[model samples]
Target chain A: MRIIDVHTHPVFMRRGLQRTEIDWLVAHGRALGIERMVTLGDVLLHGRFPTGEQISAINDVTAQVQSWYPDYFVSFCFLNPTLGERHVMSEVERCVTKYGFKGLKLEICNNASDACMKPVMEAARRWNLVVLQHSWSMTNIKQRSFHTDPADTALLARRHPDVKIIMAHLTGCGVRGVLEAKGLPNLYIDTSGGLPDEGLIEYAVEHLGVDHVLYGSDLPGRAATVAIQRVVGARLTPAERKKILYDNSARLLQLN
Target chain B: MLCDVNAFLGSWPFSIVPEYSAPQLADYLAQSGIRRAVVSHLGAVFQPDPMLANRKLLAAVRRTPALAPLPIVNPLLANWREQLTELGANAAVRAVRILPNYHNYALKSRRLDPFMDALAEAKLKLVLTARLEDERHRYFALRVKGVPCKAIAAFLARFPDHHILCTGVPLFDIQNLAEKHANFSSDLSYAENITMMEMLRDKIAPSRLMFGTFAPLVSARAQAAKLTQSPLTAQERKLIYAENARRFFSL
Candidate 1:
């Protein structure tokens, strides 16, 4: 089956930046039937609160990866929304204009409910780019001040209905995350993060519908093979599996 | 054939995971290409008396040959010996799993020494569960943490003779423990990454690593795919999939 992984960090902790390493990763992903991989830059390279220059360095590396395998890789401009509107706007424009980033990737720099996200969402809306936010159930992590919980991401989607939001980490968000995303056409959840727990994918599809659920592996930190199998192994019909595995993401990102 | 060392047979109260009957579970696991599994009763994790749950597990899998019962024994309980005796007598029982965190005992506890001694005498293996589910996603009320690696290391050092199989241990913990101790092995139920098996092979000996699906709570197919889909050598695959489990459990 043709698969498009909607969430992945090909360049992590200063690794996979080399041409040979990128080649190996591309080959490895293709071997498992991944046609295209969405590269979320090393978002945590400079820690939670990276300076503007640090953000550029990370995106530069991401842009470099896209440069090498333009056909097989799609880039996302990683942004720390807390960096304020100036940093956020300029970086989004730089990545989109130079690297042709297809989306805006937000990590744990600020909670999705924070006021600072307005400008970030505006940039996504202005550029017509998808916004992929790193999210989990903040019930346990307790870092909701900066960590974007599923509820917070849901709120972000509600506040900005125009921009498409991909709440990353379906397993981390759990059942509550799926319910939070219900009826919100602008919000989607990526099947990434944590273990491929039994029944979660089915639950997500049942609650959020197959079209709103996308396949993601959180790759380098997770396996594409296992992530693909998580959706394939779900009790959904082949058509439903095809949408999650390739069609939904392909259509959402306009990769076709 | 693959032997899963971390599957369960009861309902997880926090989630809507299927509460499968023994035959049903066997069929489900078989669909994931698991020929055999060492299963523990989820009921035992919370019950004051694990024997009741153990009995249920035994009765449920009595006719199912594909499943080998790994009864949970809470060493904190006074009747642990009786529980061990009852479990060890059964030819189908290869190992007894212990949930230290859920049972409210540290791995470094003096209570485990006597229990380890008894296990040695009975010729039954020990499967120490580092965790059952990811701590981040657990129910809000259930505050159990995974068995700490330091405590696990202390246990390994205290009992060098016992070759323990630790299920649900994270990859970093396995790497740390494998570098310092050789008396322990781990199942890959919780170890994940793009290069999961390849990275584990770099740190721990292939013989020390085994296949575990943590099924019912986790997808057996996805966990098995962690091994089946990885770029592992035939020898590594053989060792992880069956040989290691067979030799360790004496199946």
Candidate 2:
């Protein structure tokens, strides 16, 4: 089965940044049938609120990985919207024009519902790039001020219907997250983070449909084989499994 | 033939996972290549009297040969000896499980010393559950945390003669506990990383690691694949998948 992981941080905590490490990761992923991976950059290396230069350094690492294995990786430009519109727009433009980043990666710099997201979403709309937001339930974690809850991501999608959005971490989002993403056609949930809780993939598919559920592994922190198996191991038809593992991501990112 | 050491029967109120009958659970596990499982009742985790849940669990799996019943014993209960006696009387029962966090007792509590002695005298194995669900995703009202690693390490030291099997232990904790203590074995229900089994094999012997799915709360197939798709030697795979569990439980 051909698989495309929609979320991964190949260069985590300064690891996997070298050519040798990248080669090992690419080979490891391919061995488990991953045809391609979306490199979300070291989004947290500089902490939650990184300066503009720090953000560029992180994106540069992602660009370097894409440079080595252009065929194997799809780069996403990591952004901290709290850096404001001028910083956000310029970084998006730089990543897209120079590095050919395919999407925008948002971590816990600010809530998805904040007013600062306006320019960030505008850059995505202007560039026709997908936006992947880091999200969790926030019911217990209680860092909703900066952490993007599933409800907050859902609201982001609701506000900007034209911009494509991917809510990362299906297990972290749980049942409430699925319902928050129920009606919004623009929002997608990545099956990444937390334990591969039983019946969650099935539950997501049941509520949001297979098209809205994409395969992801939050890799380096998670196993690509385990993440792929979470979808394959589900009690879904082979066709549904194929969509999540391959086709849905292909369609979302316009990958051939 | 994978023998899951961490499988559960009944519903978890926080999850939407379907409640399975013993036959149904057996069939579900069989579909994912789990030949046999050591299962405990989920009802016991929340109930005031675990014996009521234990009786229901015994009755549930009595007819299913594929599942070996592991009854949950609340050691803090005044009638824990009675619980152990009744569970020991059953020829099919191999081990008794304890949920220290949910049962509102610390692993270091003196209550467990006598309880461990009873298990030792009864010739029954002890299955200590570190956690059943991820605390980050649990219900807001359920504030219970996983059994602490220090408490677990202390417990291992306290019971030097007994070999304890711990379920739902994280990967890092497994490494820490394995380095300091040799008296404990763990199931890979909650242990995960890019090369999870390979990493664990480097830290702990393959013989000390057993396969567990934490099913009905976590996916059986996904948890099994944590080993099945891992870069493990055929010997390592054999030990973790069945041999270790068989020897641990004497199944």
Candidate 3:
């Protein structure tokens, strides 16, 4: 089955940047039936809060990966919105104009509800780019000060109304996270992170609808085989599974 | 054929995973390439007395030949002796499982010394479930953690003769314990990484790792797909699939 992983940190930390490492990743992903991967860059390279320069460096690596295998990779500009409007706007403009990035990658620089995220959302709206946010259930990892919980992402989606939002890590978000993203047409949940727990993918599809579910493997930290199998093995219709595995991401990213 | 070591037959209140009876669980496992399994009951997790759940488990798997009954015994409880006696009478049972995390005890507790001795006396293998569900994603109120690797290591040291199979342990913890102790084996239900098999081969022998799906709570097809799609050799695959389990549980 053809697959498109919408959530991935292709340049995680110091890995997957070198030519050989990138080649290895592409070959491995292709072996597991993934035809395309959305490279979200190394979001944690300079820790949770990165400066504008650091953000550009991360996006540069993302652009480089996309340049290497333009057909196989889709780059998303990594942003730290806590840097305020000017910095956020300039970085997004540079990444979009220069590298042709398709989306904006938001990590734990600040909560998705912070006032500073307004300009970042504006940039996504103005550029017609999707926003993939790093969100988990804040019940356990209580770092809501900078972390974006599923509810926070939902709030961002409710506020924006125009920009698309993808909530990363279905397993980390769990059942409650699915409920939080439910009924929001603009919000999507990615199947990534942690052990591939049974019934979660199916539950997400049931609650969030098939169109709002996206395939993700948080590669390097996780394996594509396990992540893809989670969706393939779910008790979903073939069309539903196809949407989660390939078409949903394809439509969200405009991967014609 | 696959033999799952972590299959269960009871409801976990904190999870939305559908509870399966013996026949239902057997059918589920069969669909995932598991022809046989050493099963336990989830009722033992929350109940003050695991004996009731153990009795229900024994009764549930009584007729299902594909599902081998592995009763959960709480050594901390007063009637552990009776629990052992009842399970021992069943010729189909060759092993018993313990969950220190749920039972509110440590693996190093003095209560386990006698428990280990009793299992030895009964000629039953011990299966230590380090955890059942992923603690991070479980019920918001539940805060139980897995039995520490150091504590499990100390228990293995205390009883060097017993070969205990510890299930639901992470890949890193499994590697850590296997480095110091040789009297333990692990199930692959919770073990994962990009290069899982390649990573484990350096620290532990292939024979020490058995295939466990942690079924119902976790996806059997997804768990089994890892082994079925892995790059392990035929001999290593055989060892993980059925040979290792057959030899370990003495089936």
Per candidate, native contacts kept equal 0.85, 0.77, 0.63
lDDT tens string, model 1, B22-137? 99999999998999988889999998998899999999989998988889999989989998999888888888999999999888788888899999999988999999999997
> Model 3 misses residue B102 by how many Å?
0.7
- Best candidate, DockQ-wise? 1
* Of candidates 2 and 1, the better by DockQ: 1
Least well predicted 10-residue stretch by lDDT in candidate 1 chain B:
B194-203
- Candidate 2 wrongly placed segments (more than 4 Å): A13-16
Error of 2 at A158 (Å): 0.9
Candidate 1 falls in which docking quality class? high
Candidates ranked by DockQ, best first?
A: 1, 2, 3
Summed backbone clashes in each candidate are: 0, 0, 1
List the candidates' TM-scores in order.
0.99, 0.97, 0.96
**lDDT string, candidate 3, A137-209, tens digits:** 8887679999988899999999998899999999889888899998999999999988788788888888888
The TM-scores, chain A only, for the candidates as listed are 0.98, 0.98, 0.97
Which residue pairs come into collision in candidate 2? none
